[model samples]
Target: MSQLANDSRVQVRKKSKERSKFFWGMVYLAPALILMSVFIFYPVLKTIYYSFYYTNNRGIPVTFAGLDNFINLFTSESFLISMRGTFLYVLYTVPLGVVIALFLAVISSEKIRAIGIFRVIFSSTMGVSVAAGSMMFLFLFHPTIGFLNHIIGLVGISPIHWLTDPKWALISIAATSIWMGIGFNYIILLSGLQNIPEDMYEAAKIDGAGYFTRLFKITIPLVSPTLFFVIIVTVIHSFQSFGQIDILTQGGPAESTNLIVYSIYQNAFIHTKYGLASAQAIILFVIILIITIIQFKVGEKKVHYQ
Candidate 1:
C-alpha cells in the first residue's frame, strides 16, 4: 500500500509540473498569439467574409452577393486583361532576374582582389526603397530629357516613349523590376555560392572536368535549393508588384500595364467597390497558394540539399 501511494504521488507531481510548464509556455506565447490573431488571422477571415457580400464605401457588407462578384470578375474584360498582364509581368521578371543574379554571383564569387567591392556594388540596390527606385526609373524613362533617350538619339535612333507607349510600358516596368530585384537575388545566390564546398570543385578539376562541365554538373546541382527558393520568392514578388506601376504608368497607355493587384487597389479605393476588391484579393490569395503548392510539389524534386 505504501509503495503504491508513493508511485501515485510521484505521478501526480509529474503531472503538476507539466501543467505548470504548459501555463508558463502559454504566458510566453500570449503576445505573439494576440498580434497574429488581430493582424493576420482576423484580417484574413474578414476579407473572406467581405468577399461574399456587397460592401459600402466604408467597407461594411450591406447585402449578400453570393458568387456574383467572382462570376463578374471572370466575365469582365478589364479583369481578364489585368490577369494577362500580371502573368506576362511574372514571366518577364522572374527568369531574367534569376539568371542575371546567378551570373553576377558566379562572377563575383571569384577569388580575386576587390571582389568584396564588386559584391557590394552588385547588391547596393537592395538598400534602395521601392519608391526611390521607381522614381529613378521614372526619370530614366522620361521621353525628352531621359538619359536612355539621349543615348538612343546619339546612335541616330528615334527617342522612344518608354512609359507612355502601350507596347513599351509593361516592358519598361519589367526592366525596372528586374534591375531592382537583382540586388536581393544576387545577395542570396552569392551566399549560396559561398556555402558550396571548395573541395568539390577541386575534385572535379582532378577528374579533368572542364569549367563549363563542372559548373553544369556540380555548381548548379549544389545551388539548386537556393535557386528554387529565389525563384518562388521572385514569382510571388512579381505577382504582388504595384508601386512601380503606380508611379510609372498608373495603369495607363490603354490599361496595358494594369496588373491584378493594381486593379484590386483601384476597385477598393478609387471606385469604392470593396466587395469586388475583396473577391479579387481572395482570388489572388488562391492563385498564390496554388502556385506555391505546385512549386513545392514539382520543384522540390530538383532541390539538392546537402
Candidate 2:
C-alpha cells in the first residue's frame, strides 16, 4: 500500500509539472496571439462583415446590402475589365518568368569559370525594390527620351509609347513584372538545381544521353518541385501587383492596365467605397484559393521526387 501511494504521488507530480509547463507556454505565446487577433483576425472578420453591408466613408456600416455588392462587382464593367487585365498579367508574366529563371538557373549551375559573377548578375534584380524597378522601366520605355526607343531607332524601328498606348501599357507592365520576378525564381531554382545529385547526370551521360535528353529527362524532373512552387507564388504575386501600376500607369492608358488589386485600392481609398472594396477583396481571396487548390492537386501528380 505504501509503495503504491508513493508511485501515485510521483505520477501526480509529473502531471502537475506538465500542466505547469503548458500554462507557461501559453503565457509566453499570449503576446503573439493577442497581436494576431488584433491585426490579422480582426481585420479579416471586419472585412467580411463590411462586404455584406453598405458603409460610410469612415467604414461604419449603414445598411445591409445582401448580395448586392457581389452582384455589382460582377456587373461593373470596370471591375470585369480589371479582372481580365489581372488574369492577362498573370498569364503573360508567370510562364515567361519561370522559363527564364529556370534557364538562368541551369546555366548558372554549370561548372564554368567565374560562374559566381554571372549568378550575381542574374540575381541582382532581386534586390531592386518595386518602386525602383518601376521607375527604371518607366524611364526606359519612355517614347521620346527613353533609351529603349533610342536603341530601337538605330535599327530603323519607330518609337513606341509604352505606357500611354493602350495596346502596350498592360504588356509593358507585364514585361516589368517578369523582369523583376526572374531574379527571385532564378534564386529558388538555382538552389534546387544545386541540390540535384551529380551522380544522376553522370549516370545519364554514361548511358550516352545527349545534352537535351539529360536536361529534359533528368534536370527538369528533379527540379520540378521548386518550379511548381515558383509558378504558384508567381501567379499569386502577379494577381496582387499594384506598386508598379500605381507608379507607372495609375491604371490609365484608358484603364487598360487597371488590374484587380489597383481597382480594389481605387474603390476602397480613392472612391471611398469600403464595402465594395471589401467585396472585391473577398472575391480575390476566393480566386486565389481556387487557383492554389488547383495547383496543389495538379502538382501532386506532376512534382517528381528523387
Candidate 3:
C-alpha cells in the first residue's frame, strides 16, 4: 500500500513538471508571437482596410469608395498593359529559371574536381544587387556601343536596340532577370541533388538506364518537391519584379514593359492616388494568393517527398 502511494506521488510530480515546462516554453515563444502579430498580421489588416478608402492631397480621407477603384483599374489601358507584361514576365521567368537551375545542378553534381570553386562561380551572381545588375545589363545591351551588339556585328547583323525598342525591351529585361536569378535557383537545386541517394543512381545504371533516362525517370521524380518549391518562389518573385524594370526600362519606349507592381508604385507615390494604389495592391494580393493556392493544389499531387 505504501509503495502504491509513492508511485502515485511520483506520477503527480511528473505531471506538474510537464506543466511547468510547457508554461516556460510559451513564455519563450511569446516575444516572437507578439512581433509577428505587430509586424505581419497588423500590416495585412491595415492594408486591406486602407484599400477600401480614398485619400486626397490633404491626407487619407476615411470614406469608403466601394468597388470604384477596382473598376477604374480594370478599365484603365495602362493597367491592362501592366497586367500583360507582368504575366509575360512570370511565365518566362519561372520555367526558364527552373530548367536552367536543374541543368546546372545536374552538371555540378557530376564527379568533377574543384566542385566547390565551380559552385561559387555559378552562385556568385546572386550576391549582385538588382539595380546594379540591371544597369550592367543595360550597358551590355546598348545599341551601337554594346558588347552584345558588337558580337552580333561579326555575324552580319545590325545592332539591336535592346532597351530602347519596345519589342525588345521586355525581352532584354527578362534576360537580365534570368541571369540574376539562375544562380540562386541553381544553389537550391544543387542542394536538393546532393541530398538524393547515390545508391538509387547506381541501381538505375545497373538496370541499363542511360544518363538522360535516369535523369528524366529518377532524378526528376525524386527532386520534384524541391523543384515545386523553387517554382512557387520564383513565380512570386517574378510577380514582384520592380527594380529591374525601374532601373533598365522605367516602363519605357511607350510603357511597354510597365509591370503591375511598378504601376502601383507610380499611382501611390508618383500620382499620390493612395486609395487607387491600395486597391490595385489589394487586387494584386488576391491574384497572387489565388495563383499560389492553385499551384499548391496542383503541385501537391506531383511532389514526391520520399
Candidate 4:
C-alpha cells in the first residue's frame, strides 16, 4: 500500500511538471502567435470572406454576391489583358535574369585579379529601392534628353519614345526589372558557386573535358539547386512587379504594361471595387501557388544534389 502510494505521487508530480513546461512554452510563443494572427491569419480569412461578397469603398461586405465576384473577375477584359502582360513580363525577366546572373557569378568566381570589383559593380543594384531604380531607368530611357538616346544617336539610330510608346513600354519595364533582379540572383548564385568543391573541376579537367564540357557536365549540375531557387524567386518577383510599372507607365499607352498586381491595386484602391479586388487577389494567389507547386515538382527532377 505504501509503495503504491509513493509511485502514484511521483507520477502525478511528473505530469504536473510537464504541464507547467508546456504552459510556459506557450507563453513564450504568445507574441509571435498574436502577430501572425493579427497580420497574416486574420487578413487572409477576411480577404477570403470578402471575396464572395459585395464590398464598398470601406471594405465592408455590403451584400452576399455568391460566385458573381469570381465570375466577373474571369470575364473582365482588363483582367485578361493584365494577365497577358504579366505573362510577358515573366517571360522577359525570369529566364534571362537567371542566365545573366549565373554568367556574372561564374565570371566573378574566377581567380583573376580585380574580380571583386566587378562583383561589386554587378551587385550594387541590390541597394537601390524599386522606386529609385524605376526613376533612374525612366530618366535614362527618356527620349530626347536621355543618355541612352544620345549614345544611340551617335550610331545614327533614331531616338525612340521608351515609356510613352506601347511597343516599348513593357519591354523597358522588363529591362529595369532584370537590372534590379540580377544583383540578388548574382549574390545567391555566387555563394553557391563558392561552395562547390574545387577538386571536382580539377578531376573534370584531368579527364580532358574542355571548358564548355566541364561547365555543362559538372558546374551546371552542381549549381542547379541554386539556379532553381533563383528562377523560382525571380518568377515570383516578376509576378509581383508593381512599383516600376506604376511609376513609369501607369499601365498606359493602351494598358500594355498593366500587370496583374497593378490591376489589383487599381480595382481595390483606385476604383473602390473592394470585393472584386479581393476575388482577383485570391485568384492571383491561386495562380502563384499553382506555379510554385509546378516548379517544385518539375525542378526537383532536374536539380542535382551533391
Query: How many clashes would you count in candidate 1?
Result: 0
Number of the top candidate by lDDT? 1
Q: Write candidate 2's Cα lDDT for 1-306 as tens digits.
A: 999999999999999999999999999999999999999999999999999999998878999999899999999899999999889889999888899999999989999999999999999999999999999999999999999999999999999999999999999999999998888999999999999999999999999999999999999999999888899999899889999999999998889999999999999999999999999999999999999999998876989976
Question: Could you tell me which 10 consecutive residues in candidate 1 have the lowest summed lDDT?
Answer: 50-59
lDDT of each: 0.95, 0.94, 0.89, 0.92
Estimate, for each residue in 8-72, the C-alpha lDDT of model 1 and write its tens digit. Answer: 99999999999999999999999999999999999899989989999888989999999999999
Which tens-of-lDDT digit does each residue in 100-185 have in candidate 4? 99999988998999888999999998999999999999899999998899999999999989999999999999999999998999
Which pairs in model 1 have colliding backbones?
none
From the highest lDDT down, the ranking of the candidates is: 1, 2, 4, 3
Candidate 4 RMSD computed on C-alpha atoms after optimal superposition onto the true structure: 2.1
* Model 2 misplacement above 4 A: 1-21
The clash count for each model shown is 0, 0, 0, 0
Worst 10 residues of 2 by lDDT: 297-306
Model 4 scores a C-alpha lDDT of 0.92
Clashes of 3: 0
Q: Which residue pairs collide in model 2, if any?
A: none
Best by TM-score: 1
